[model samples]
Target: MRIAHATAATAAAALLTLLGTAPPATATTRPAGPPATTARPPAPIAWGSCPDSTADTRQQCATLAVPLDHADPTGPQLDLAVSRITAARPDQRRGALLIVPGGPGNPGLNGPTNAVRRLPRSVLDRYDLIGFDPRGVGRSSPVDCGLAHDDLSMTTLLPWPAPDGSVTGNLAAARRIADACTRNGGPVLRSISTRNEARDMDRIRQALGERRISAWGVSYGTYAGAVYATMYPDRTDRIVLDSNDDPDPSRVERGWLAAYATGAEDRFPDFAAWAAAPAAGDQRLADTPQQVRDLFLRLAARLDTAPLPWPGANPARLDGNALRAAMLDTLYDDARFPRLARLMLAADGRAELPPAATPPDAAMQNTVAASAATMCNDVRWPRSADGYARAVAADRTAHPLTAGMPVNVMPCAFWPTDPAEPPTRITPDGPSNILMVQNLRDPATPYAGALRLRAALGDRARLVSVDSGGHDAYAAHGNACGDRLVTRFLVDGRRPAHDTLCPAEH
Candidate 1:
C-alpha cells in the first residue's frame, strides 16, 4: 500500500503474526458515489491476547466482524483484524485513538504498534492506540483482482508514461486492467471503496465500546478521517491529520491522484537543492542547484532514448519508466536521497541500482488490487478521454521530471463499476478538536493540497504548516515544534487558536 504505516516494536509483532492471512467469506454492495449503506455493527470483536505475553500487559489483538456491506449488516459479514496497545497508563487514558492509515489500500493492523514509537509520551500515556486493517487489506479479509504478475508492476500500478510520452500504451493498459478486475474480482473486491472503509471504522468504534474516538490520520487516512467526521461528527473527539490532501467533493481520490504533478514539481526542487549541496561526505549530484536540475532532466531524457540493462528486475531492464519509479519512491522520505543519487550515478555510468526491491508475491498483488479497487470504486474519474489528454499534456510540458505520469491514466479510466455513495464533503461543522500539521514543500502531499483541506474543514481544524519538505511532518519529521503542537492537542485536547506556521530549520 502507498500509505505509510506506522513502524514500532508493537507493529513488528503484529506484522509477524499476520504472516499468513485470508479473505472474508461474505460480501454485498454499496451504491456508487454515496454514503455507505448502513449495516449492523460487526458482531462483538473477538479480543485476543498479544502473543508476546511477556511484553507490556496492555497490548492485545482481536477480530471485528463488520458487514461486508454496510447496506446489509446481517446479510454478509467480514472479519476486521484489530490490535490495540493500551496507553502506558490507563488512569491517564482519555479514550481510544484510531490510527487511520493513508493508502486506500494501506492496512492499519500494524499501525497501533508502529504509531506508538513516534507518538509523544504524553499522548501515549493518555490514549489507547487502536489500529485495524480496513476491509480488504492485510489480515482483515484480503481481496485480489486475480491479476497476473505483469499487471502488478510499479509502472502499471502508477500509470506512468511509455518511454516517449505516448498514451497508446497507457490507454491499452488501463482498459486491460479494468477489464481484468471486473472479470476476476469478487463482491468483496468490488466493495473495497473508501466509503465502506469509513463505515467499517465506525463499526470499529462501536465494537470497541467507545462513544467517541480520537484519531491520528495521515495522507489518505486524512481523507478517511475527514469522511468519518463528516458522517459521524458526534462520535469524533480529538482528530489529528498529517500531510493533508484536498477535499474536492466533485473529485475526491481523482483530485488527489491528479495533484501529484504539482506535488512532484514542488518537491523536486528540494531534491535538487540536496543533490546540489556541497560534496559533504558521499552526497553526489552537482555542486550547484541549477546544475543538479539540468543533470537529472538530461539523464531522464537520455534514459528515455536509451535505457540501461539490469537483471532480476521486472521488465528486465532499467529504463526511463524505471527511473521515474525510483524518483517517486525516493520522494516519500529524505533518507532515500541516496537512492536517487545512486540512480543518477548509475545513469551516468557511475553505479548500478542496489538490489531491486522484491517483487510482490500473490498477497502483495492482491493488496495492490484491493488498493486500486478502493480508489476507482470510491469515486468516478473524469469520463472524457480529453480530460486526461489535456491534463497529461499540460503536466508533461510543466513537469518533465514526472513525465505527466502524475496526471496520466489508470484503472480509474476503465473502472467497471460506479461509486457506491455520494463522495463525502468535508465540512467545518465537525468536532472542534482537529489539529492538522503539514510541511510547505512536501514532495508527495504538498502544502497547497493541505490548504485545500484546511479550507474544507474551516472551523473544525487548525493548521500547523511547517516550512519543510517530506511526505509526512508530524512525529516522523523531527520538527519538535510541530511534534509538540500535535502532542498538546492529542493529549490535552488543546488546539491552536488559529492556523500557524512553523519556520523551517536548516
Candidate 2:
C-alpha cells in the first residue's frame, strides 16, 4: 500500500495520499547488521521552529546527523529532519511513539502533524509522537537520479508493458534509468536501501536518548519496521506494522511488485460491486458486478487500439495502460471509485475527459530515484530481458487487470551497486510487543502478504485483520473495531492473546 498512487486529477497535489503513495517493498531474511548500537548515548536535540507548511502548532522540528554508511560512522554524515509533538499530558507520558510513513521515499517529518489529527487523545497524551525523513528523502540529504522527466511518470516507473505485452520498451527504460542513476546519483543514492534506512532509524533512536523506541510503520514502513525490530529486538517497546508487505526474503522487492497481481484480483470485486450499484446512475458501467468487470476489460482493450488525445498527460494520450494504471490507483480506496467510474465514462464517450494529473517532476524524480535504489539495493533482480519478457507474457494472460506490469522489468535489473548487506530476515526473535493491523482486501499490500509477515514474526506479533477493502487498515479506514484494538494496544500495552479478525462495519 505504500506504493504511491496518483489520480489523473490530483496527482500533482502531493506525493503522499492516505497511508502513502508509492509502491511497496518486502524485508530480507539475513542478519546484515552494523552491529546493534544501544550503548551509544547521544546529545540532546536542539529543537527549533517547524516549516511554515507545518499545520500543528505543537509540532517541533530538529535534525539528527547519521553516517552515510553505517559501517564507517565517522564517514560523511547526512542530516535527518526530525519532528515531534510532545505528549499533551506529560504526567501520563510513557515513551516516544514514532509514526513511520509508507514509502521508502515518503517524507516522515510531517507525519507527527498528521498523526495529531488522527490519533486518539488518550494515545496522544501517553506518548510523544515522533517523525523523520529517512536518508535520501526530503530534507534528509535528498538524492536524485536526474532521470528524464518522461521516465518519472507512474506509468513508466511502474513498468506497464505495451499493448502486445512486449517488454522491449520497458527493458530500454530500465537501462536508461539505471545508467542515469549511476551517472548522476552520487554516493547517497547508492547508499539508499531498506537495511540502511533501518540503521538510520537506530541512529535516530540513539539521538533521542531512548533505551527503546515504539513505532507504527505502514506499507513500505512495515518492512523497514520489521528490519529495525529484527536488528534491535530488545530496543523496541511497542510496534504496530500496518498494511504489511510480504517478507519473502528470496524475492524481496520482486515479491512486493508481483503482489499487485494478487492484490488487484483480491480487491477488484469491491470496485465492481460499487460500480454496479444503482446509486452509480450515469456513472455505472453495468447492472451487475460481472457485467462491470466485462465492461472494464473490453473498454481497456479498445483503448489499447485507439488512444484518445490527452493534451497535458505525460504521454499526451489516454491509452489502455493509462486506464489500467488509474484502475490500480483507484482500487486503493473506495472513495476514489467515482474517479475511475468517471474516467470510464469519458473513455466510453459518455462524458468529457478530466484534466491530466501528475506529481511535480522534481518531486517524482527524487521519489522514484530513492524508491528504485531501495528496491534494487535490497536484493538482486533477474537481469535477463528475455526472461522478463517471458514472465510478462505469462502474467499478462494470467492477470489482465495488471497487464504484466507487476512482474515486468525495472531499473533494478540494471542497478549499478549491490546490496551493502543482506535484507534483514524477520524472525520470531523479537519481543512479543508487536501488533499488526491489516485489511482483508488491501490493493497494495494484500491480506495474504500480511499473513506471511505475521507468520515470520511468529509469537513476537499479533494480527488484527479488518474486513475492509483499502490500502491502510488502522486509522485511515473507518473500522472502529480495528481502530479500538490498535489504540488499546498502543495506549495500554494490551493486545489480543491470539490473532483476531474485526468484521466489516454494518
Candidate 3:
C-alpha cells in the first residue's frame, strides 16, 4: 500500500478517549467567500493518452489551469493534473463520479483506474470515474519545502518526544521544519489548503461541463468533500464518504491529530487478538490477547532506553517512537499485521530486522510539504510550546502506546502564516444526498470520530457501519453488507432507511 503522508499518520490520533456522545454542535454559518477570480471559464479539458507508466490503458489524462490562490485567481495560475475513465455503458451514464483521495497530499491521478477494478460493474457502467491531483501535489504544480533528508523521516515529521516524555527536542525539530517550509516553499505551498482543494474540485466540475458531480472521498478527503457539499449543496449528487473524519470546525485538523490516541487504543486490541491466535503460526506473540498487549508494552518500554540499530530504516534505529509509529501505520490494514509482528519478534530476539521500505526522497519532500501546507494553513495551531508539552504529557500518561505523538508539537505549532480563512463548518442544511461507510475499528479514522461526522451531517446523510477493523471501508476492508449498501447508494440512489451496521467479515 502507498505510504500516507507522515503528518497524515501523526494527525490520526485524538487527544481524548473515545466519547460515546457526539461533539456539541458548532456555528452553522458558512465562512466568507474567497476573493473573486477572473471571470474567464476554463476551457474544456483536452483529453490525451495517459503516461507510459500509467497501468490502465482505459484511463485518459488531462490538465486544468486554476488560480494559485482562489482569493486572487487572476494573479497567477497553476496546473491541476486530472484523469478520467468514461462509463462502460455510455448510454446509461449518470454523470461523473469524482474520487477524492485521502491525504491532503496524496496524488489522486490514478483514482479512476484503481476504482474501476473494485466498484460494482453497474456503478462503473453508469458513471464516468474522475480523479485529479489537487494543487501542489503530484503531477499538479508540486510544492517542496526543500527539507533535508533527515527532516523527511517519519519519526522527525511526527514530533515524537524523547523516551522520558521531554519535548525539548520536539520543539526544536518543529521550529526547524517550519523554518524550512517558510524558506523553500513558495506561494504555491501557501495555496495548498482544503478550501482551495474544494475550489479546485469545483473548477474540475466546470471544466467537465457537469452541473453536479458525485464523489467518493476517503480519510482527509472526507473533510474536503464535506466542505464542498456544504459550500456548493446544489452542485452535489451522490456522495460517499468512506472512513470519515470529524468535521468539528473549531478543531479541524487538530482534532484529527488528537484522535490518534483513541484510535490506537481502539485498534490495538484487534492486533493483539490476531497476534495471539494459534493460527498465527510463527508470528504469534503470545497465547492470549492480554499477553500480546503486555509483551508489546514491555518491549516498547525496553526499546525506549536501548534502541537496536537497524541498517535500512530511517534514523537507522528501532527506538520506542519508531516502534509506536510502526504500530500506528500497520494498524491501518490487517494485511500489515505481519509488519508489526516481525518488529516485535526482532525486539524479542526471535527474528532479524526486516528490509525497510522507503519512498523516493523527492516524493517524501513533496508529500510532507503539501500535507503541512494544507493542515497548517487550514487552521491555527497553538503557538505555545508549553501548551503542547502539557498536552503531550497528559496524552502519554493516558495512552502509552502512542507516546504522546498525537498531541505533541508539530511544524504547524510554529507555522509562519495563519489560516487565510476560518475552517468551514459542516452543517445539516445541505441536500440529503450523502452516504458514509466506515469500519468500526479504524486506526486512522476511528468509529468515534465517524460518529461526530454522522451527527454533524444530521438529516443530510445515512451511515453504514461495518463491524470490522481497518480504514477505507467500502469495497476495501469492508464486508459485503457494507459494500452493498454503499454500492447500491451510488448505483441506484438507494440508501438504508436509517443508520445500519454490517456484521464483521469472517
Candidate 2 ranges with C-alpha deviation above 4 Å = 4-31, 36-40
Q: Write the number of the candidate with greater TM-score, choosing between 2 and 3.
A: 2
lDDT, residue 102, candidate 3:
76
In candidate 3 the C-alpha lDDT for residue 72 amounts to: 61
lDDT per model, in order?
A: 0.73, 0.81, 0.81
Model 3, 92-193: lDDT tens per residue?
Answer: 999999999877677789889889888989999999999998888888999888887787777877778898889998787778888888888888886777
lDDT, candidate 3, residue 172? 78
- Candidate 2: residue 456 Cα off by (Å): 0.5
RMSD of each: 5.1, 3.9, 5.0
The candidate with the higher lDDT, 1 or 2, is 2
Residue pairs with backbone atoms closer than 3 Å in model 2 (clashes): 2-22, 3-21, 3-22, 3-23, 4-21, 4-22, 28-424, 29-425
For model 2, what is the alpha-carbon lDDT of residue 121?
A: 94
